[model samples]
Target: MVARGRVLVIEEVPSQETFALWDGVRAEGWDVTAAPLAATVDAVRRAAPDVVVLNLHGAGDADRRALYLQAAGRLALTRTPRRPPILLVGDAGPDEKPLGVADVIRGPYSARHVAQRIGSLSRLSTMQQEMMRRVETAGQYGVVPPELEPSNQFHEPKVLVVGAGIRYFAIERTLARRATLVGAFTVDTALDYLERQAFDCVVLNMRVQEAAEFTARLRRNVDHFALPVVVLADPREVDEVDAAYAAGADDVVFHSGESAIFAERVATVLKEHRLRESLKAAYARSRDRATNDALTGLFARGFLLDHLSRMVEAAAHGGRLSIVGFRIANIDEVNRQHGYAAGDHLIRQVGTVIGRLVRGEDLAARPGGGRFVIVLPDTHVDDAAGVAARLGAVLRATRFALPGASEPVSAEVVSAVADRIDGDDAESLVARVTL
Candidate 1:
């Protein structure tokens, strides 16, 4: 089994009580290192402890508290990219708060209290390291893309934790106890993960360095904006809580030391997210059924005509628009020779070819049986004629294999072109090309 985690104990001068606390922490299965307060900077570099326990009971005056805080700041500066959580064992006067510290316990406490705090912090650290290891390993090999399916209800919720701090990883551990965690080391990595995977909720710790910036960044990204974010706020820092809301946090989870609360908050957000996704998927399916043809997978005739009206209106306002119309002359012959299924195969093949030739913004539709139309935006009459000519040539040159036939059938295509005129409506423009 792996060691639980490492702890660094810092003291101005080692006392009997401090040694006793560390002894208890060690018995709990942690790698404990005791160093004088003056040598903390060096000892942190060597041991790389996950939790730093600061012993300040020896300080008898306010000046000593100031010095201890200064020393804590120096230790923070020594670690780059990621700083360990600091657990202070000292008494704080009113209006006294140490920056970047995780927790504080007053003097004259038992060794068990210190051990409890260290255990919690160490467990969180181990969770972070383990989750990050899984992420980096996946990045090396790669993950298969999720299947495209209509989601009607909640699946297993994949939660993303967006920092390496104590509460952030603790939330990861909490959620992992109930669900699997999709971990990320920074906001950028989280954004990348969101693009590559489907997640139900996100938990962000505002205490991490540059966390506020990352939250804003996540909000600005279009792909990640709708993702539900649960901000873990420090109950004492009112400004941070407000900032999290201003940055578009969907929910806030205050640090209350209860893991169950964290897990429940994530579950609630996940339910909401699943509902939103279900509505979106249902809307898309309904829209596609209304607008698309059942056989050819192209836009339906009525929808295409309505869209052509909009294109014509835009062309009247100084934009260019062209239409290419084509009809397969041998479609009836093929149907009679083989069957109706062969005719459908021909139409689908023609639709696929047109789809391949058109630009992403161009629209392809079948206004009637064997008659196809392509609306090309920002195009002149010359270009439209060129597209029509290309369609005719391709249809004649390519032989399509019909179902249960020994030989392939060559299609004969008759094509026409139309450009938007000064006095033209959707019906007139479409008639000029089709008739």
Candidate 2:
């Protein structure tokens, strides 16, 4: 496993305890080096560590101020684009804050405690950089990331367990508290299930020969791109954790650990994944609203025309395409006599009827004022006419129940059907049907 970040330790006189602490950080897969306090700025300029660890042991106020000034100088060096996060270690409480550090660790700190603080500060810095990058990208692209609302409502999250082992069973039992766990003995089976249905997260076992490949492929898949993956490894195989992360695993858990820990890790990953999925779903809904009519819940005029254009090209290659233009025959009179509400009620009822009649492959849209259009791909003129006639007859005979109406209001539908001509375009086809 390769180290992720470099850490530079600045200590005027290195003690055994300080060296031990540096060794512990190295064990955690961080590139760490020691430098004398006098050479701190020059070392920082050369090494360009992701973070600087300053030992303020037995230092006076003047010394602390001078060290902070040196650290600040490194920020202006050409090699360092931004100031690296600094951790000040001394016998101090929260009240004794350092001038040039992101965080402070009071004395009597264990190696693990120091490493954990460094890791957290590093991750926070990474997140901040990522956010700034997203903001810049959004400015360039003219589209901002959607802000999603936090939801406390818990639905049973669906989890897919890949590969066969005792860990799978343990995960199944543990995750069942909040998730519905389904097992896939092989990667192919997992993909088949994924294609057929959506899974909120995948618990992948590192022991599976293809687990790494599976994670890569899963991330590449469009449907599962945002889906969270948690890789599980046996304690003996802890070295595989780096591979799991490289393969796009969101979190890795050792199967030998407590079942509760496994469950909690899974839950945390799921919470974040669900937040992202909510944002994406919201963005999709906003896009749909932009391209669709609010009144009829159908494609708007511009979008409908764009579809027509593509279908026309396909029709030229011997594909069948049909368009049906329909309107409420007495919509004007209904609006004049009963009011806009009655007219709107009539149109909505007609849309409902058309929606029920059209096949899943067909598109029904309220393209403009008091008019609707249905695009039937791979449909002949006769088939389109039959559909239009059925819709027209049903709409004319069915009495639409309107709000505050004495009786159900009866209405008539007038429709025209047009098939793609040899030289037809989107405009011509739509014009023919409406004319």
Candidate 3:
């Protein structure tokens, strides 16, 4: 894969021996360098590497989280002359808490897996900005790019002009040249359908309906959403232009000019909106990257807490809840004996087997570390324990192939399970595993 810059390694023990072993990566034409763990940001600044590999030293969960954020923040805020993606290597120690973030590789990670992750992150950076925009919009607005114009066509300007007045008819004719008339509204009726569908712009003519009611609904919409609007009013009520704008009208037109000008104003607003969408999309992407781990496609730490908290509340009123936290021991040894890629394969295998073992209503999530927690609703303590034992047995039974290793590697699991007792909440339930 192609990268924009070199990769810098920051770890507790970036010994000459470690560097020698990783020379295969250097052989692949990657400029790999090592620096002291505390000098992560400094190394990043000097090397300006595409990826940052961390050699953790058995830090606790809190420390691991803080470190992950520290590195992630450095990557995000320190705008360089040239920015490269940050890839973290978390294979430094056994029982070390990892953020489950930034290309995390626990102990025993495969060298090939590490190389592939670095390569893939670089390739992902080459994703086209236009394609990014399209993707960003798809999640929020169900729209196709070419269909934007055709979709905006609401009604026939000619047919709409048949009733209003001679001056209005002239205005409609002018508008007909530049814009496709969407649904037209006279005095009594305003748009009731906009609430249901996505619209880039809305056109409301107050000539037929009372301006106050129509404006009221428009104002309600303004309170509810952000959509560009053009209000058509009687020339006599031009004094209401201030109110129209206040009520969220982008442009207000009367018999003062033709419909052509009205259409032009609407088009301008839509163009501005496209820019707003881009900014919003980029902001959202950065925010998502902040807490989310891209590899497993799991919810971020904050999201998981908010979600599980809500689940706990629901479980309080609805029924009992059980939760289990599990960790795989000896996997780190496997990675060191074999390679990180094999370790990653085992993690995925564990995740899959545990996912399949749970009930449909239950939730299984990794909260920022290698630690996996499963929440089972309406489950008793005994059942929760049984599930945990079954999961442990699965880990014990499953055999995995390793890279550059003599024998197959499997997991040794230590798990804790608990159920709601009395009015116990999420934090307390989770603490039960500790008890």
Candidate 4:
């Protein structure tokens, strides 16, 4: 189990309330601090909180958010290349105004909610810092060697709670069986020590209201963080998980419904980048086989439709578009005289000629046994026709010499107008040009 780290609470509440919340966090094995919300910036810089919780009930909630954004933007520790998780505690408006903390809590925070939020935000911050450290230590190559990996690799994903009273001890054993557990404190020395450590993810199990407020405070800090965050929400409103992400929660899982998914979900996110690389390689190979012809270097007819459709979605405004179709005129005669190999050689040459004459965006593909289509994006019909005419000239000029050939082979190029398409869809545009 990983250790719980320091947590700083900046609340506009009574000292006793702060103490109570402070006690709950401490019971969870955390070094907790209850400072005035106004002094949050200095305290955080001085003490450097793993997680900072703010109360909108404090003076100038709005200003705090703005100042925090600016202050956090410059803080070298918080602004490290990797980002931390933030908690905001507040109500949802058209915009969840920044309370200057990473996470926010809605008004009427509960002790349980505050405790959970603290736990989650702290771990997430730790994870964010870990990723940054990893990326930095690897330098330009960006690979974490085995030595580096084992030296200070983060613990397996799990929630770590600070303070002890909140049943943090029991959960520690439970989490350790399947996940890594962590602990820390808000006291200056303890906070300093934990700052050097790392974790995989964070979960804040605060009361619904405190979770909201804590989430609001956490928003800025985690805005740039990539670590996964799960808010401990009541099963009743589990559907509000979507709202959580919209406000900056990486993830939200109800303890009642999601006990099974916690460990698995954490592992998936931590490994997401590697999985993406694997999937991308597989997809590229499959796509190449489907789109490219083996014998001739031209794309297949089916490939044209698929690629054109995709390109249309990303086409530039007022870009030119053109399409050309050409017939082999007398492919059978040449096949009969020479052989299949010679025929293939001629096709390859024609594909090469078309490829050389066109731009990178242009598509040259064999539509059928003896037909070809050239799709030219960002081109006018007249311009495409002119290019086709030039290509026809190239075909006539090039003597496609066969192994035993005495003369050169030529092709008849036919082109039609498809200038200035009204619709953006690929099929309709191709139809207009083909017709």
Candidate 5:
């Protein structure tokens, strides 16, 4: 299997728990490497991990601070495309919020939870790097890039609390000063609130079974799949904690009445979520008519080829890259039967669906007519095939309304996927699938 990403763990004295964490993360499809604290800088520079986990469980306060500073300094000095976020594996004190520390996983927690955090941080790092490159590329086309600095204007995050009881009150009180809170006592009420308005995150304070069900339901919806979710559970109940992570909870907080710690954890997740949203928005703003297809609102054919050439060169240094081609097999027939206008409408609708289905980092382009292509960097052929199949299925299922026909028309979509091999140029890679 293709590795999800690389993870480097720094520990002065490795323990069984640390080894177990590596094993679990490796099983979760991440390539994990362990390095002594003394070699932290060298290991990080050599491995170039997507994220770093520093274990200071047995270190003194001074030692912990020094180790973190050392790691942060090395990361700052290293000239990488994106600096990996550091995850402190031990308690870093309530008020000791150090720079460069993405998050702190305190107290007793399962390896799965840590792995999930690593995955999120890794993806965030990749997205940030991609955004920078895309912005730079767009600048070449005379598209003005969005300002990189954080906006002075602040928007209070809106949070939905789904459940009642002491934990709900604790969450509400903790976020009262920092966010806008809306309480939903029942699952139905929460779902209704979600439909009515947008929320930055959702805190589930109900029973584990109910919360798990609710999280699964939210994951099924395309709009809410990436929404942050925090499941409140009793630390003593190990089963509940496992269930929460299994159901795709972003963070499972063990409720011990420590509202301060809870607040910090929630804040970490919220910050990451907001940063991701901002990057996506910035990239969208950088798109111009010169680089985007007129009807599809996707990258123009020329822009896609230029970007793919750069990606092909970068993939030379150990990485996976895949391209997917989508063809509306019966588009010509539809145009002849119903008018060219109806055919254009059908193509436009299909393009919209492709844009919505693809990830923010994936580049989708309409090379004219019913042919579209998507470039997925850091994605293996199997995963790219899965994405292609899903897009094809959705397109096939969609019914299109024609101008004169009483019955809606259906589509026949043909999809092909190809991975970059040893000696492949952008044109050659795209041709393998599109041709």
Candidate 6:
């Protein structure tokens, strides 16, 4: 299996608690490393972690501050193009908030929650690095990338509160200062609100089962798949917390009635969500007609080659690049049974499914006919194969309607995965998978 990302834990004294935390994070599919505070600088340079976790559990105020600064400074000095974010795994005073820290997990926290935060930070770091590389490649083709101008206008985040009683009031009061709050007493009402207006985050102030069900429902919708969902649950119900994460809750906060802490956690999740939205917009704006397939709105064949070439060159420096190639095996059959127009319609629907399934950073291209390729940067061949499987499953599940067909037709998608070899170029890399 492909690891989520690499994480380095910097702790002065190792304890059973810390060891358990490492085991849990590792179980979550992350590569975790433990190092002492004295070796912080060298450990980071040597490990080149995607995120750094600082254990400040038993440290005093001064000690905590010093450790945080030292870790952040050493990470800044590291010569890697992608600098890791610091995740403080203990109490952080109000005054201890620093500029490079991704988040601070205070009070009694679960290992699963910490792992989720690490995964978020790691993905953000990777997206930033990918953006930089894509910009350079676009420039090479004389295609000017979109300028991400700093906006002077500030909009308050809109938050939806789904629950009832005192918790709803507490959430309203907590977010009133920082956001605009809308309350929904029932699941149907919450779904209605979601369809009508946009929200930065959804706070489920209900029972664990209800919250999990609502979360799963939101995830099924394409528009709301990436929207952040925070579940407020009773600390005593440990199994419910696991179920929440399993149902796709972004963060599960045990209800402690601490309004300030809840507000801060919600803010942290919102910040990451907005940052991802900005990056996605930049990716969309960076594309032009010359680079995109007109019918499918995917990357064109020529642009795919150019981008793949740059990715292959970068792989020499140390990184993984894999391609998932797909072909609609029955396109010609569909054309013969129906007409050329029906074939085109089927192709368009397939493209739409592929576009929805891929990550923002993954480049999906329609290289013409029934062939499609998805370039997965920093992805291993095994992971690439998993992606291909998902695409195939979804395509096979979908039934395309034709102009003169008695019944809806299902797609037969054939897929192959190829990782870049030592002597592979853009043409050879794509051919290995597609051909």
**Top-TM-score structure, candidate number:** 6
Q: What does candidate 5's lDDT look like per residue over 295-353, in tens digits?
A: 87888888888888888887777666889999989988998988898898888888887
Across 1-435, the per-residue lDDT of candidate 2 in tens digits comes to: 225467888877677777787897787657889887768777887786777887766345766646654664454453554457787776544344445666666544445446655754564454344334333333433545455444334578889988886667777777777888889988889889999987889988647235667876765544564467887766665545556555556766666546665675577667655554443343334335546677776667776676677667755653467899997778888888788898898788777666555543466778776788988765557657766775666567678887656788887678999888788898888887663
Please list the C-alpha lDDT of all candidates, in the order they appear.
0.65, 0.67, 0.52, 0.51, 0.78, 0.79
Off by over 4 Å in 5: 58-65, 78-82, 148-153, 207-212, 219-222, 234-249, 320-337, 379-402, 405-421, 431-435
lDDT-better candidate, 1 vs 4: 1
Q: Which pairs of residues clash in candidate 6, taking residues 3 or more apart in a chain or in different chains? A: none
Model 1: per-residue lDDT, tens digit, 1-435? 223456788877677866777787677556788787778778877776778877777655778767778877787667443368787776664234487566665533344435555644543343333233323322333432222243434356677887776665677667776676877877678878988987777888657225556666665543455567877766665435445544556556557676665565566556545544543333233335556677777767876777777678756654567888888888899889899999899888887666545433456788878888888665557656765764566566677887956698877888889888779887787777773
Worst 10 residues of 5 by lDDT: 144-153
2 or 5: which has the higher TM-score?
5
Kindly indicate the candidate among 4 and 6 with the higher lDDT. 6
RMSD to the true structure for each prediction, in A, is 24.4, 19.4, 26.5, 24.5, 3.5, 3.5
- After superposing candidate 1, which stretches have Cα over 4 Å from the reference? 1-287
- In what order do the candidates fall by lDDT, top score first? 6, 5, 2, 1, 3, 4
Model with the higher TM-score, candidate 1 or 2? 2
Q: Estimate each model's TM-score.
A: 0.35, 0.39, 0.32, 0.32, 0.84, 0.85
Candidate 4 Cα misplacement greater than 4 A, ranges:
1-287, 313-319, 423-425, 428-435
Q: What TM-score does candidate 4 get on C-alpha atoms?
A: 0.32
lDDT of 6 by residue, 59-160 (tens): 457856586667666666667655788888776774355656767777657778788888777766766777787787777778888866421128888899
In model 5, what are the clashing residue pairs, if there are any?
Answer: none
RMSD of 6: 3.5
**Model 2 / residue 87 / CA error / Å:** 14
Q: Candidate 3, residues 1-435: lDDT per residue as tens digits?
A: 222236676665455645654675665446678776567666777775656666554224657646654766666666674355665555433223234233444323234334544544443332222234333433333323232222223543221221244555555565656544445435332353444544556556545244444544544432223455655666666445556544444455454453443454455455444444443343334334433334343334454455456557645553356788877777677677667777776677666565545433355566633567777654556556766775666567667665676676677778998766667766666656532
